[model samples]
Target: MRIRKVIPGDARPARSAPGGEEAARDPQFVEAIARGFTILEAFTTRDSMLGNQEIAERSGLPRPTISRLTHTLTRLGYLEYLPRFAKYQLGIAAVALGQLALANMAVRGVARPLMEALSQRLGASVSLGRRDRLSMLYVEHAQPASAVALQLGLGSRLPLAVTAMGRAYYAVAQAEERAAIDQQIEERFPERWARVRDALHEAVDMHAALGFTISIGDWNREVHAAGAAIILPDGGIAAFNCGAPAFMLDRDRVLREAGPGVSEMARRVLSIASGKG
Candidate 1:
């Protein structure tokens, strides 16, 4: 498989000074800008809303730093303010940027029509994502006729170890790349790594056998997910997944049906991505 060169803003290791040196490395708020993004990254698949104090505590940035960054982010339209509740949430501009990126991505166009068809057939939500360093970035997502559906917006980042989409992509990555991604995860999110590290071998075997991976509440409780990779022309992979609330999707039926459908759709999307379609 070919490794592509980095495009601007493609996720990479957050280069601060080696471990304890971060606070002492910069005189200006270069560290502050880094801290601001760190605070932003603290919001994730599990946690949505956070108070200033919560952000301060989570990011390890001072309370004043968190406050200034939150205020600036809110004013810049990247965050929303809830004055009464003293909480902050992602704002419209964040969603808009995500939508714009999805609109422009070549992989998204090739995967969209197929995802829609798959969603209709399975009556569940379908999602497409790519590995950005150790994270899975949502690139395309579709929902089926069921009353409730996962509403992950484009550009949302999910952990790559516990989630099916993450595992599928991880399985396709080259050994060195996989190790690097894993190392980054271990360093960045140690607690999460402890949970999924031992499961890697099993996940790899599952991908080799099924041509995809299935996750049940590994990332989100009561959420069931199945994922496969669209192999590009160069033998690289782009990841995609389908998710449904456990109550709506029978686990056995998904394993029997959705698994194959997602695998087949991924192959088709790969063909299209490679210009073979």
Candidate 2:
């Protein structure tokens, strides 16, 4: 069977510059590099290995283009060709790049202790995340020593529409940025927008009113989470989230107990991040 094409409409909007007129006007933009990255991103946890045809379908590129790009990437050590399966998987270079990126982020070092302490105190999983395109990318994570926690790790990504971390980040974003993201979400997930739109607005309002947001089974049916955002001394915005299994943290408890605690923790973290603590 032919692999389903992963068209632009099937995925989140590009976090980079807008396409069409905006892209055409940018003379310094490199389309080849962007296309190469797109091809690399076609391999996922579920789709770990892909042939040139599958990569072409998933990246919305022509087969010939994918063939050339894949070969180039393989030569650069960004992808490894699997002879047995006749497919390609991420290479050690990708892991090295990701590790280097994480190693250089100062905020992760600054937030690790606080996240550890918070997770220990609350018996929940604590995560630090930043905006990656339209999703929240986990940069650092901590879990209680003795508790069973969510199996999230560095580089894990959650949706911007329903995750508490995503909402918290959105709430703190500038008006124009938020508007652009909102428009993109509406366009990307039109079928689900009506159901999620009102809840998203409510989350933003809650964050504005209470310094944090709560999500109970909104993103995942088995999880409950709360989040708040902080602006680092370097002016980068990041969100911290605490989450637990739905069986362990019900909706009322999240709103009544975890919500306030997470909010206060966020404020303290923000103070530390801003060098005011």
Candidate 3:
């Protein structure tokens, strides 16, 4: 295979620059992309629908900069400006991008069988995840064929401080990284952080002792989970987890039945990552 070098002055035909300068040389265009993403991120749980001023305040960009970014994003169909309410919201383009990304995950092929086997053997919800910042994005999930089952699927994102899998991942992280994650969680989600921080320290220590992390009703009420992490080549944490309704399975049962398989699968993934497969 031959590698093609990117010429410094190359430009894409669809989006032409004013001169023959390469796209990388345009600092103004770079800033525009940054400001646009910042504007989008400004709309969070606390402020879902935001006006230009709110977006500016949250993003720390000037009001005029936010207004221009919003206009560009709205024009690109990534944002919708509500003229009647004078607010901006995420539009269909974002949903379309999410759908496209999920479609490419190959969850059914790679993870479904493993999760199904784990679920049936343990009589629980077995989930595989890829960590994303403070969240765990589900790669696959398999639940028992019970009527009162959790409806989580491949695309669901679980908070790191709130889910067993998330804690397991954090426990496997280095001390410094875990501390940084802890600080961010405490700073960002202070309410939940206050309730869980002390227990989380104990949980981290317990994971070191027990070789896994367990949580009961941490993320979802009445949901019990035991989880372990698979350390990837780049030191990112992926996880395997099993959850059940509190009355259905206890921590001992989860560890005894589900822990081995999850850990074995994690080892297999790590081994493959290490080029041993």
The number of clashing residue pairs in each candidate reads 0, 0, 0
Worst 10 residues of 2 by lDDT: 1-10
Candidate 2 structure quality by residue, lDDT tens digits, 142-230: 87764466766666778877888988998888888888887777777788878777877888899989888988888778889898887
Q: Where does candidate 2 stray beyond 4 Å?
A: 1-29, 45-47
By lDDT, highest first, what's the ranking? 2, 1, 3
Per-candidate TM equals: 0.74, 0.84, 0.64
> In TM-score terms, which candidate is top?
2
Which pairs in model 2 have colliding backbones? none
Relative to the true structure, candidate 2 reaches a TM of: 0.84
Instruction: Return the number of clashes found in candidate 2.
Output: 0
The lDDT leader among the candidates is: 2
Tens digits of lDDT, candidate 1, 1-277: 4222211222233333222444555455466567666767766555668898877767677778778899999998888988888798888987787677666678778888999999988877788888766678887788776556665655567778878888888877789988887777787778878667777667778888988788887777777878887567766578888877777666786688777788889999877777788
C-alpha lDDT of all candidate models, in order: 0.75, 0.79, 0.68
